[model samples]
Target: MSNLSATSTAQNSSTPIVLTIAGSDSGGGAGIQADIKAISATGGYACSVITVITAQNTLGVSAIFPIPLEHIEKQLDAVFSDLNVVAVKVGMLADCDIIKLVAAKIRQYRPAFLVVDPVMIATSGDLLLKAYSISTLKSELLPLADLITPNLPEAAELISSDVPTNKEGMEKMIGKLRKLKFNALLLKGGHLIDDENSNDLLILPNHVEQLNAIRINTLNTHGTGCTLSSAIASYLAQGNDLLRAVQLGKDYISQAIAHADELDVGQGHGPVNHFFVGHANVR
Candidate 1:
C-alpha cells in the first residue's frame, strides 16, 4: 500500500509530458518512432497519436498508408483524457482532413507549447503531404504553432518564392516569416553550400538566435529534423523557454549526430544513434 501511494503521488506530479501526433517509421529512424526516442532521451514522457504509417528504412520510404481521420481523433482523445500534455509536436500530416482534426484538438486542449515540423518531403525526395493539404496546412495548422521548424526547401514553399541561399537573403526570408504572427521561426540552413558546420537562423518577435551545428559528414542523417523538433518539444514540455529549448535541442542533436557518425544502418542513408551510451547528462 505504501509503494502504491508513492506511485500515485508520482503519477499525479508527472515530470513532463509531450505529445507527438505523427506518422510511424518502421525503421525507427523518423516519424513517431524518432519522436518518442527524442522525447524520452530528453527527460520527458511521450504520448503519441499516429496519423500514418510508412514502410521505410535509411535507403528510402517504400510505401505510405495514412490512418483514417476518426482514428486520429481517437488516439488524441485517449491521450488527452489520461495525460496532462505540456507540449505537442506534429509531423507528417499526410492529408488536410487529418490536419484539420489535429488543429481542432490543439485548440481544444491548448497545450503550453506546440511545434510543427511540416514533413513535406522525405529524406530521399518523397512527397509526404497531398497537394491540396498545402494550402490548408498554411492557413489552418501552421499559425497555431508556437514554433515552425522549416528547412530551406520548406521555407521556399511556405511563402511560394525562392529561398535566398546566403545569410543576408536567409535573414530577409526569416523576416518575412516573422510577420506571420508565429511565436518563433526556426529556419534551418541545411541546403546552403557552406563549410563543415551548418547554420540555423531563428527569428522571433523581438530576439534573434543563431545555432551553429557541426554537420556530421556521414550518411546517417535520416531522422535529423524529426529528432530536433521532438527534442525542442521535450524541453518545452518541461517548462523551458522557447529559446532555451531550441538551444538544448540543437545540442542534443549535435551530440546524437556525432555519436552515430560511423554506424551504418542501410544501403544509402542512415539514422542517428539516439541511445548512444556513456553520456553523463542527457536533456
Candidate 2:
C-alpha cells in the first residue's frame, strides 16, 4: 500500500481512524452505537456523523427525527478536515436529502475504503429509511460504495425481485446486483430460514468467496449487520484486502453472537457483545 493508504492504518499510529455515518440508536444496540463498538473492538478508532436519532429500544423504533443537512455537513467537515480517515461505513440515511448529502461529502473525501450497509428495515419490523428515498439511495449512494452489504430482503428490494431462498438463487441475485458497479458485494444469508449455517456470499469482479458459520441461536441479534459491516471497515483500515477483511469480520461477528447472552441490556432482542474480550483480558 502507498503511504497515502497507510495514513489511516491504526496499527501504524496509536489507532487507525474509521468513520461511520448512520443514525443514533438510543437503545445502544444498533446504528452508530453498534458501529462504534464493533470498530473499536476490531482495532480501529471510530468517529461518527449521525444522520438521525430514533426513539427506540429492543422492542421497536417509535419515532425518528433526521439531523439537519447543514449539521450533518458540518460533522463531516470537522472529521475529514483533521482525521486521516482510512475507511467509512454508511447506514440508515433516513431521507432523500440526507442520502444525497452523505453521498456528496463521501465522494469529495474519497476515503480508501467504504462499506455501505443497505439498512432498510429494523430487526423489529420497523422501517428505518424513508420509502421515497430508496431510489436516491440506489442511484446516488450505492455506486460509490467499495462494498455494499445487503441482506436477503434488502437485495430483493434493491432489484425489485423476490427474496432468494437458496444458494443458487442468491448467486443469481448477486449477478443482478453486480451490474450496479460496486467494487464488491456481500450478500448476507443469515436471514435464510432453513439454513443450519449462516452462509454469506462475497462477490468480486473476478472471484466469489463463501463465508459460512454455524448459526448461533439467540434473540440478541439486533445489530448483527451493523457490527459485521463496521468490523469489515475496521479490518480494511488495518490494511487487509477486501476478502481478508470480510473473513475476519465474519469471525468477529460470530464470536460476538456466541457471547451476546452475557450482556443483559434489553428486554426484547439485545445486542451482541462487541467487546467479547476486554482489553485487560487480552494476552
Candidate 3:
C-alpha cells in the first residue's frame, strides 16, 4: 500500500472534486472518458485513475490491458493525496487483485461517497471482467460502495441467478438482491428490451423507489451505465441527498439518450451526447 498523505488545501476550493477509478476507453465513449465528461458536465471537478486500457470503440472491445498493481497504487496515492475527492465512482476492475487493492485504498482514504458500477460485459458482448474476479467484486468491493449500479445482467451475475425478462421477474429478484452487503442497489432495467419504458429500482434497506424514463429508441446508447453512475456521484458531491441525486442523474441520462442521435461518432452503438446543450439546468 502507498503511504501518501492527503493535503488539507483541497477543502478550500469552491468546486467539488470527484474521482473516477476505471478503465480507459480509447473510444472516448465509456469508462474513464465518459465518467470525466459526466462529472464535469454535472458541476464537479473530475480526476481519474485508470485501471485498464482497452482497445475499444463503439463497435466492440478488441483487447484489454490491466494496469500493474504498483502503478495502480501510485495512481490512487497521487489523486487522494492532492484532491479533496468528495465522491468516488469505481468501474472495471479486471481481476481479483485489482478489486482488493481498490477496496483497501477506499478504506484508507474514506471518500465521503462511493459509487460502484459493477461493469462486466460490454454493450458489444465483450467480457471486461475476468470470470474469477466476480467473487472478489461481490465480497471485497461492493460492500464498501455507498451505491452499486448494476444492470439486469450484472445483478443476475451478482446473485448467481438467471436474468429476469420482465417487470414481475425484476421485482421477484429484490429479495435475492437484498441479501448482498451493500448500502444501496440501483437495478437498471434498460436491458428489458420489450418494455416501452426504461425503469430502474433503487433498493435501500427500508425502501425501494422506482425511477422511470420513457425508453428512447436509439443505437447510441453506449456508456449509459458509466454516465449515469458518474452523474449521480457528481450530484452527491454537490451535497444533494441520495434520492435527489439519483433523480437528477436519471434525468441527465434520459436527456442524453434522447439527444444521442444528434452526434455522429461511430457506425454502431454510438455514444450519447454528453455535451448535449438541452439539459443546461441539470447541474
Per-model CA lDDT versus the true structure: 0.81, 0.87, 0.90
- 1-283: candidate 2 lDDT, tens digit per residue: 1122443344565567899999999999999999999998888889999999999899999999999999999999999999988889999899999999988998898887889999998889898877788889999988888889998888888888998887778888867887776778899998886789999999888888899999998999989999999998888888777778898899999999999999998899999998887531111
Q: Which order, best to worst by TM-score?
A: 3, 2, 1
lDDT for 264 in candidate 3 is 95
Candidate 3 Cα errors over 4 Å, as ranges: 1-13, 281-283
Per-residue C-alpha lDDT of model 1 across residues 85-146, encoded as one tens digit per residue? 87889999999889899999988887777899988887787888887788899888888888
Which candidate comes out best when scored by TM-score?
3
Q: What is the TM-score of each candidate against the true structure?
A: 0.91, 0.93, 0.95
The segments of candidate 1 whose C-alpha lies over 4 angstroms from its true place after superposition are 1-12, 278-280
lDDT, candidate 3, 163-216, per-residue tens: 999999999999999999998889999999999999999999999999999999
Residue pairs with clashing backbones, model 2: 10-15, 10-16
